[model samples]
Target: MSLENELKSLIIAELKLVDIKAEDINDDQPLFGEGLGLDSLDAVELVVLLQRHYKIETKDLEQSKEVFASVRSLANYIRAQQDRK
Candidate 1:
């Protein structure tokens, strides 16, 4: 599957979201606040999702800021990591 579709699936499955599709998410849309209505718990879940999906280890808070900026960033990171492996 494409990165977009894979991410959509991963987000829905990992976050236990309902009635959402890939098209529902904007690439640069904020994952928190009014964008996705995600909270700290959702952020934690997203961390787990990144670990499982990207196979990348992110420890620093600053690094996470860039990596998990949005779905596009996350997917790009995942693709890069997957390529490395």
Candidate 2:
């Protein structure tokens, strides 16, 4: 599967988003606010999800904002990090 789709699955599974499915998520859809209705706590869970699954560590707050913007962005970030390794 595509990284974006994989990320969507991971996000939904890790965050326990019982109301949503991977197919329901859009690549460019916002993860927070009105998009997926994610909150700060979900952001924290996302961080843990990245580390646990992708071995990624997002330490910069500003960068995290961009990295966590959407499923596409998260997939890009994961790919970039993997490329570095």
Candidate 3:
């Protein structure tokens, strides 16, 4: 699967978002607030998901904010990290 799709799936599964489907998420749609109805706890789960699944460390608060913006942003961040390796 594409990275965005994969990230969507991870978000749904990890967050236990029972009503959401991977295909239902838009790449540019915000993961929090009005877009997915996610809250701060969801953000924490996403951080763990990224670290566990992709080994993407997001310990920096400001950087984590940008990385968790959307599926596309997370995918780009993962890709960029992979490139650096």
For this target, which candidate reaches the highest TM-score against the unseen true structure? 2
Q: How many residue pairs clash in each candidate?
A: 0, 0, 0
Candidate 1's clash total is: 0
Q: Write the per-residue lDDT of candidate 2 for residues 1-85, one digit (tens) a residue.
A: 9988888888877888897889999999999999999999999999999999888999999999999999989989999999999
Candidate 1 Cα lDDT to native? 0.80
Worst 10 residues of 2 by lDDT: 10-19
Model 3: runs farther than 4 Å from truth? none
Whole-model Cα lDDT of every candidate shown, in order: 0.80, 0.91, 0.89
User: TM-score order of candidates, best first?
Assistant: 2, 3, 1
**TM-score for all predictions?**
0.82, 0.95, 0.94
Candidate number achieving the greatest lDDT relative to the actual structure: 2
- Alpha-carbon RMSD, each predicted model: 1.7, 0.8, 0.8
Which tens-of-lDDT digit does each residue in 24-82 have in candidate 1? 88888877787777788987888887777666777888978787778888888778878
Instruction: Write candidate 3's Cα lDDT for 30-81 as tens digits.
Output: 9888988899989888888888998888889999889889999999999999
Model 3 lDDT on a 0 to 1 scale: 0.89
